[model samples]
Target: MDPYTSFQVPTGDRPKYTGKKLVMLSPDASMKNIDAEASGAALRLAPSSAYKSHEEDYIKAFEEGDGIVFEKFRIAVINANHEEQIKSLLYARRSFQYEEPERYLYALDGPRSSNFGVLLWQMLCRLFGIKKDPPEIDPDPAPKDPLPESPPVFENTGEAYWGLHALDTLANSFTGKGVKLAVLDTGMYLAHPDFASRQMVTKSFIRGESVDDINGHGTHCAGIAVGGTRGESGIRYGTASEANLYVGKVLSNAGVGSDSGILAGMEWAVEEGCRVISMSLGASVEEDSNYSNIYNELAGMAMDMGTLIIGAAGNDSRRSQGRISAVNHPANCPNILAVGALDRRSEIADFSCGGLNPNGGLVDIAGPGVEVFSSWKTPQEYAILSGTSMATPFVAGVAAQLLEAFPEATAREVWDKLVDQARPLPLPVRDVGAGLVQSPK
Candidate 1:
């Protein structure tokens, strides 16, 4: 059995870990120290091979398999420099570090920590470039900067039953009661100009860090979902401009994270009482397998409890991805609203994953996900990204609006309304579930 199962840990429970760790210092003899990257680097020289080569006699003596017990095990490469940075990271001092983590941190913790994660919090940061010191970018900028005026009143989009027009119609019917929609992704850019008038609740799942967006994906979704639903951006006036936002940082800077991290965010979302949880993220696990059922069960539970979970259909447009339908995970859970991508030109995105399950269970909706621009970290900037990542939010933000219209509605009711309004695709039923979700009159 998997250790996770053996631990009897419910998949719905967020991974609660004690924010504690032991510290160690490199001996005086180590490699030559180098200039700073993120945290301070302490250089030192070290002797080679602290332990002699293991012999068969010693191996046999310790064959019991439970001999030496480490108080803690974390990866770090032993080098003359970057020792202090590694120390600060383990103890949770620095927000990030830029270095060959595998060379130092991996050496200390072992290979386990150096995989996908190093590519995010460590590697991507290096690729994008890192600062030698903390960003003092206007520390404590005046909070009194007069909030910008709310944008113009949204005109009705007539009644588009599905796709973009329906989404636009939903925008016109919003109640502006400030319903909460939590998005689990990289993080949000709370300070963007399009969001100056909006309120946000932010949290982090990455252990020590605060909710700082690194990949820019999460923030972009935030802007499109319920951003400043008005202004020169046109009716780009976010789908639910009146809704509140909760950003849950699960993916790292490299756009990568573990299943445990995503699960942790889900648990937190339910606890926060968010009316809607939009997850424009997903994975393609092995098909026709129970390997992914644990996640599906969790999503189903969330749906049953009245929370709507929206997920991306992934970017791989294909019929079958290695015995599995192209539907993305959490999205495949039958309970979720799996959204696929459509380019602005109104065509299925070549890379938009599709083709339904042989079991008949996914791709419940489609939306315009390409060339869509939204919030960035700076008030004056934004990023135009495309993918089902953008499509899922289109439905979620509208669901928040639906909540305003049907406050007494359950998750199923919300789905019913969208289904009642969506435009049916000509493709096979399995290829595009119940058509595209849309706004109802």
Candidate 2:
């Protein structure tokens, strides 16, 4: 059972591309020299011989397409009309006939029936036996015995912070030295004293801005992931103290970003040989809807290239008020690790999101997010914040440590290691997944 089968789009209305749709084109695998420019050229210059009518409009749409071409995916940022979308989808399907994603279109407005003609096209292909049925969803397992809450053990370790001490970072001496980690979020402030010894690679995907911390979210996340040196107060935070940091300002100073900027940042990180990518941003989505097929494909390619991506599950849910929400976009995708939040008492944070979807959406692990203390922007060099955003980089920093420990391990292997070593908590799997994410021993 394909999990996506559960998502039912109302056919009463045709899909509309109200704004720009991020279109991902499949790469021509046969062409060893198939580059983004070449692929874009193919989509732009090649005659739409498949169209029996309205060829001029289709050519015009391709000519007007403006976007980046990656090694495995070509993102065509276009204000698509119905005809243009249908023709583009058809071209992609015809070009890559086997194992292609069912859909390639993503609307910034939302997932509308009219935007996903490929779903209907997929059914047509099934009727002609061009594709096999997607893999069935595994039935939910019987409830396992609740894991016993592990008692907290406190000791002086470095800054003696409970979060880092719990993971035994000082004892293990796994500071993620020499590993390359990327944090994709608002931005980073390089003038901070903690990062003075580190050489960072930075980029700003948000238009008309430099990679500098302004909204403080990305700087905070970067501090948690890789900020080194003791603060003026002598608190030692950040797990990967020595890891090479790559900061991409995906979100703008107003703390907002689009899917294109985020996607472009991911591509740039992977191209820079980043093994661990941390994202602390997302949009609210329902349980029934899975992440975009484009994100799933991009994550798949990233994993194949030895990069592990982690995202915040979301912070929309308030379990204390009996409100529980599904994981957020991109994080809901299977290949990306969805991190939930935990309080100092080792309990689920009230504001942390959960794994609510019976099928594809679920939290992968837990991290210290509630009232978590870490570096912030200047003037106020420290702050305590709570959200799945705070939790995600903790996991990413630990992932960097794992990469340093197991230098040759693939992304999947590192993921398995984290799950296998997690500290089991007395909580439901839906609330806490495989328990709190642990550090490399």
Candidate 3:
């Protein structure tokens, strides 16, 4: 019996969570029942509509338990911000403890994560709430982990770098020259030879600001975009090899970060004049937040000023994709292109998200996402891995190529050209927007 309240919301503007209690109906209750319960309490309805989907935005707020599935879109209202207030007004209301947000936190976008951290707790329990313990992630369960020297040229096979051909072709044409790319994952190793000539712009969004590739994912993506292979260590063929590089440390050495840190990274990338931004991360959101719109519009503005944004569909191969299942955020925005995965065979990657978006649109495009090889930060190793993560750079590299071919083209034009030149798929045309992006069209 969580007390629910509502407020009027403008139609086009996305929701900016205002530190109010947000509780779902009892597990067994239906939307109809929830509506009835609200009516019985005589709580006035507040308009709670956001133009953007909040699925990916809310992933950080609630980690699922074995028996819970609070992922559906539902009518929600804001009530008082205290347990006493909730109890006094609503009969038999189940209470979400109100507490304050963590003091150590720094957010990239405050509007998106306002309902989480302390704001969520304070709106319910009215005190600095004690956080529930996080589930422990075990150490070393992967089939492989780099130990005592990683590969110098590849991850799965030395052949992973073949994707390098795509980036080089774009550079050969000069589209990527001087463009700034911000890698917002794990930190980058300052000594990677390929970036020696690059203008390095770095920042730490997390605590203990170390801009090092602790988990190696950032290094891999960076290598594909622009890295010095063994023989050409002096002159690498990167997607935008001559482009400036900015490394934003959002994800930690473990490749994990909070929603705010990631959002902050986006803002920083835009502020740095990066022409292209790529993300290999994913999460869930139940409500749209101001943070989403701010970033979307920022990217839109970037597109207007010549920036291209690309996001990985995610590596969650499970058929159901965590719940509110669809592609990841930022990429799902109409203005941004969402990339799904595919393998060397050119088939839809098993982990790829396919279908019309629940929010009314098709997921964007597909690319060569599987088993791609690229440089890693570990002194000697490179890797061959799969994920739309691997696919996104291909698109970015192609965008760089578009810049070279059509130096005067807008970001939208470059994206349009990439789609126009895409190879048609035998399946899921709606799920895979244009076509698989090829190199240097």
Candidate 4:
């Protein structure tokens, strides 16, 4: 029922939850039949179209158990706060009652308020089976150039990073020719002279935004993966220079993106026959966390269809201060390659995240990330940034190179070759899994 029409609201008060909500339901709730029940409930409180709009976003119901993962719901609650509204809804729906079969209804993300906190605490303790408190959200700060006093030495190619040079040495026979490589991130600055000769397939998932990358992160990553041998400034950056580029602007110009948009881009990349899909974005999660079932399933499906996904292990650690963080999501999914960052000295970068969680949460490889220079959005046209985000695309480029070398290799075979050829490092497996990523000879 519409919370406003179903319950009385205090005069002049505002609704606490106006944003989207994420919900997880019990295993018994069939997605096929649940729509009618959900719409019926919505009609009791709001217009029928309210549920109709969100219908397409639901994942397919499982066969063994009809559970849905990270299903989105747009909910409003008149003048009552989110917690109060949810409580009232649960009471009315009676789905959470001990006697009811639907005993696992949970609101994963909601308004941040005392009542909401209390509700989440109660739910996590009683239903979600997660004992630890939810981890705080801390986005890694934007990467900056290394200290001026200690500049990194450039390779023979004029690139100050070793990742591309390493790949060039190990896989000189393949240039990722004819392979489709997709980098999904902030939009690209295609007008940059470094990419002037390369024809690119581009699409912007962000509504009302152009494919031009204003943030520079996407262009930087693209440079690492498939940029030309020489930029307008004469620096040789990028790997897989001969590969076909598919630029999917999943994140907006402001460097923010929704889960739905990113997933859509993933689907598009796979459909376009991209052999490698690289993503340098993720959200924080607690240590020893389980992989995201949603992304695990999505990536696994893509892998079965012959596409390999690569993502950053995240840059949430501060080893100098001894604060360690876990691998972030999507990359935390086992089917995807989670890449960590290495410095010029072959040491793990101070801010590169580690593999604290097992099962889909392990770091698969390392790449040169510290003091790395690459192409950026125009006006500046080049940048030097440090993060696991930078390391991820280097591996993606190497994956493209692998595809070029072994044209008939399955996605799993390509993944195994990279792991098999990885140069062993001195760091712990959690810090640099199979060690530095190596190219196919």
lDDT-based ranking: 2, 4, 1, 3
What are the models' TM-scores?
A: 0.60, 0.77, 0.59, 0.69
lDDT of 2: 0.68
Clashes of each: 23, 5, 41, 6
Off by over 4 Å in 3: 1-160, 164-175, 231-237, 285-295, 319-325, 358-361
| Per-residue lDDT of candidate 1, residues 366-434 (tens digit) | 766655656665544676566778777788877887898888898888887876676554433344455
Q: Which ranges of candidate 2 are over 4 A from the true structure?
A: 1-18, 27-65, 80-92, 96-142, 149-158
Per-candidate alpha-carbon RMSD to the true structure: 20.4, 14.0, 17.9, 13.9
lDDT of 4 at 27: 39
Error of model 1, residue 416, in angstroms: 1.8
Candidate 2 lDDT by residue in tens digits, 291-341: 666777788889999999998888777554456778878788888999888
How much lDDT does each candidate structure score?
0.53, 0.68, 0.52, 0.65
- Higher-TM-score candidate of 1 and 2: 2
Sequence-dependent TM-score of model 2: 0.77
Measured with C-alpha atoms, the lDDT of residue 77 in candidate 1 is: 22
